[model samples]
Target chain A: MSKHSIIISNISKSYGNIKAVDDISLNVKKGELFGLIGSDGAGKTTLLRILTTLLLSDSGNAQIENFDVKNNYKNIRQIVGYMPGRFSLYEDLSVEENLNFFASIFNTTVAQNYDLIKDVYSYIEPFKKRRAGQLSGGMKQKLALSCALIHKPKVLFLDEPTTGVDAVSRKEFWGMLKNLQKKDITIMVSTPYMDEAGLCDRISLMQNGKFMETDTPENIINKFQKQIYSIKSKNKQKLIKDLRKYKQTYSANIFGQAIHYIDKRNNIKIDELKNHLKSENHIDIEIKAVKPNIEDCFIELMKKEQSAVTNQLKN
Target chain B: MIPIIFIMPVVQLVILVYAANLEMKEINIIVINNDYGSLSRQLTDKFSSSPFFNVSFGNSHKEANSLMKKDKADIIMTIPHNFEKKLIKEKSADIQLLFNAVNGTKAAVAAGYCKNIIFNFNKDIIVNSPKLILEPINYKRINIINQFWYNPQLDYKIYMSTGILVILITIVSLFLSSMNLVREKEIGTIEQINVTPIKKFHFIAGKLIPFLIIALFELAFGLIIAKLLFNLPMSGSLLLLFVVAAIYLIAMLGLGLFISTVTETQQQAMFIAFFFYLVFIMMSGIFTPAESMPEWAQKINYINPVAWFMRVIRMILLKGSGFAQIKNEIFILTGYSITVLSLAVWRYRKTG
Candidate 1:
């Protein structure tokens, strides 16, 4: 077997004029938990679908466990388990029936792979006789994960599995993924939540069908290259407007309770920003430099990419 | 679903069989006695005595004409003045029979009844009075005897109920099978199934077999109803009927799967299935004979599975036909099943 569980080379797919996966290439090593972090319509689902052999690429080739996605799809299908963005299980079937059905389709019994899904299945096991449609959102996610893992697949693809799920369940779901990784199953999960990026071993920040960066979450945050200051005042709405009007402001965005402001000049004084806001009829001003997170890196990279496109258009 | 498969067929069979009758009955007649003579009275008595006609007396042609205008009378018979004297003196007389022709079939049947009654009255007069004959001439008369085959009584229920049974089976199998795969697609479960290692042939067969069994059961139930309720004949072997029905169902189920593959939603599948069903049933010779249809329509019916089954079922049940008599239809259905099922399997795709 190849060292890589999944390999792609310049895979590109387009719908009419819009490119869904634009000249993308990546490699997921054996037993690695890789995350594709991007907002909705960022082509994460499209790329995952192509890798799962459910869609054909307009140009390029991909492989799963050294089997070509086009010519050897049958072999790829045997080793990979895919959970689509929507809850796609039979709603009328009971929880136990859904798990057994997927197991049988793959020519395996649920008892054979019970160890792999024990942690996740235990959450919903008490309601195994209940119909799938009657389960809550979080319970449905657990059942879906259990069914996907029921066949002991070598690789699993989960597309936005945490979307629309409660926060506590989302955390527990990632914990379950960590347990599956320990069993040597390569996992590729996509999510729109930026905080989830820290949960994966290596994360790829994607936007507009392109990957901005692919590295550890800490490394991406450390490479921000510009200092971001979290500024607050009594009037947040007015403070944001004044900050944008400031000549030195490179970008000013409202992040939760404060504004994450970046100056054009790297070497800047905090008093200069404070004075500008102070002059805008502000009171009780607080300004402090804060460490950037994955969301900060993502916004910075997206801004750079947009300016680059505008420059090309000028040329 | 169980009720739809079992109870619906029985309800439809009973309702449609009794509703679609064509036999004529109780025709009303109004008699205008202008002569007030014994012979005219005797003619009126003859019309009243016939089982097919309900006779009433009217004084004048105007009165009977008004009754016909009001739709109260089906036929108005105007007897001429001096009808007995004219017949005795000149051996001829004129009587006008006016019929309400709004319902053309009813009008024609009523006219035929009036002619038979008048003919019988003339024969009675000729037999009773030999002096009225100017000369006795010898002539040879050839009597034609009528015998209706297959349906000796020409029972309309037997013909209609069998055809309706075929329609019932078609609806159960075709609509259900066509909606099955599309329902999966609409609910997004098909994507989950497509990722499995299941082959296309197995998937298609799995969808087809259950509906096929249900449709076959419906056919048997309908046949039993035909035997018990309508007293429909079962001249041919029941086993042969089922074998042909199985082949025919395979063809119908294949067509349904094909429709499912081409459509993305259950509603679309239903519309397409209904369109083909309407065309097939209209040309299936159920209500009208396929032989009498336009030449182009008959040619189109070659591909209509319902038409083939309608003809074969009637032939077997009514004519008591054997395998040799229906071998041609069986072969055609087999070929049709292979072609359509292959098309369905070929059209189904595991990847997009």
Candidate 2:
């Protein structure tokens, strides 16, 4: 087997005038849990589809386990498992029948892969006789995962697996993924939920069919050069407007109950900031230096990329 | 689905059979009996008493002809003056028969009924007259011996129900197979299938096999209902009928799959199937004779699967025709099956 689970080099796909996946390249190491984190319409699903052999890239070289995606698609298909964005199992069939049918299609039996799907299937075992269409969203999700893993595929591609799922179920699904990772299955998952990015061993933040950054979550956060400060006031809405008007304020956005602001300079004078807020008639105010999270790092990267594009347009 | 496979065909066959009759009844006849003799009156009684015609008397041929022109009379029979005297003296009589040939089949059948009545009247006259009977050699009469084979009584239900059964089977299989495949595409389950290691032809075969079994079973079910209800003839081997149905379904299901492959939604598939059903059923000689249609229409039936199946079922059910006689139809259907099925498989894209 190849050392890397998937190698996608310079892939691009377009639909009419819109480019869905544009000049993207990445390599996923064997047994690694890689995540593609992007908002809706960020081309995350498109890239995952191409990697799973369900679609072909217009211009790229993609291989799974060293099998070419175009010429050796059949070979690639045999080695990969895919869970699409939609809950696509046969609804008329009971959960057990759906799993069995998928297993039989790959020329394998459920008994052969019992241990592979044991953990994931356990959650849905009680309702195995219920029709998939009648299952709740979380149960359907677990059933889909069980069916996808039944064949013991080398690589599992999940496109937004936790989307439309409740928070507790989402956490349980990640726990299941963590258990599967112990089995040394290379898993690639995509989601718009930024908090789920920390669960993956590594993640790529994508925007407009291109990757803005790809690294471990800690590395991405540490790469943020700006010092972030959380400011609060009695009137939260007015505080955001007043902070944006500050001369040294570079970026100010509301993050939950506190407004996060970064200055043009690396350091901020607490006394000066207090005086400025006092002059603006902000009462019961509190300000503190806080660490940046994934969302904060994401906003910073987006701002940097936007300014670069603006400069290019101006030139 | 159960209703479509089991109950729908039986209901359509039962209801449509009554509406499918082609036998003509209640033909209006206007008679001008100028002779005013017993012989003319006797012939007039025959027309009125028979169930096939309704008789009306006119004073003269002018009124009779006018009545016919006005569409009141379907036939006009005129007895010439001195008709009884001429028959007694010369041993022959003259009469004029005119018919409205608007519907050619109905007119022809009506004429046959009239000829039978007239021939029987002549026999009665010859048998009753003592002079003619004593000198039997004076008049030479020719009699026609007619025999209707296969269907001695010519029951319309037998022929129509068989044709209807074939059409029902064809439509159900075609519609179900196509809709089944397209439903997957609509619900996005086809994406799951596409990502698997399933072969393209295997997928197509999987779609066809279930409907094929259901269609074949329904065919047998419909045949049983036909036999029980209408006493439909079963002179041919049951195995032969099943064999032909098996081959015919390959062509139908293939065509349905071909339609599904080209269409994106079930609605589109249904519309396209309906278009083909209209063309194929109309031109398949189901309700009308194929020979009576235009030449171009007959040529179009060569490619129509329903036309082939309709012809085969009638031949098998009514005539008890063996497989050797329908070899040409089977061959053509096999060719259609190959061409359409290959196109269906070739056009279906696993990766798009």
TM-score of chain A of each: 0.98, 0.97
In model 1, state the lDDT of residue A157. 98
Clashes of each: 0, 0
**Total clashes in model 1, counting residue pairs 3 or more apart in sequence or in different chains:** 0
For candidate 2, the docking band is medium
DockQ of 2: 0.70
Clashing pairs in 2: none
Off by over 4 Å in 2: A232-249, A269-286, B26-45, B54-142
lDDT of 1 by residue, B247-331 (tens): 9999999999999999999999999999999999989999879999889888988999889999999988899888999999999
Error (Å) of candidate 2 at residue A138 is 0.6
- Per-residue lDDT over B74-192 for candidate 2, one digit per residue giving the tens place of the 0 to 100 score: 99888998998888788889998899999888899999999999988887788786545346674566766788998999898998898888888888778887787789999989999
lDDT of 2 by residue, A80-149 (tens): 8999999999999999999999999999999999999999899999999999999999999999999899
Score every model by TM-score. 0.92, 0.88
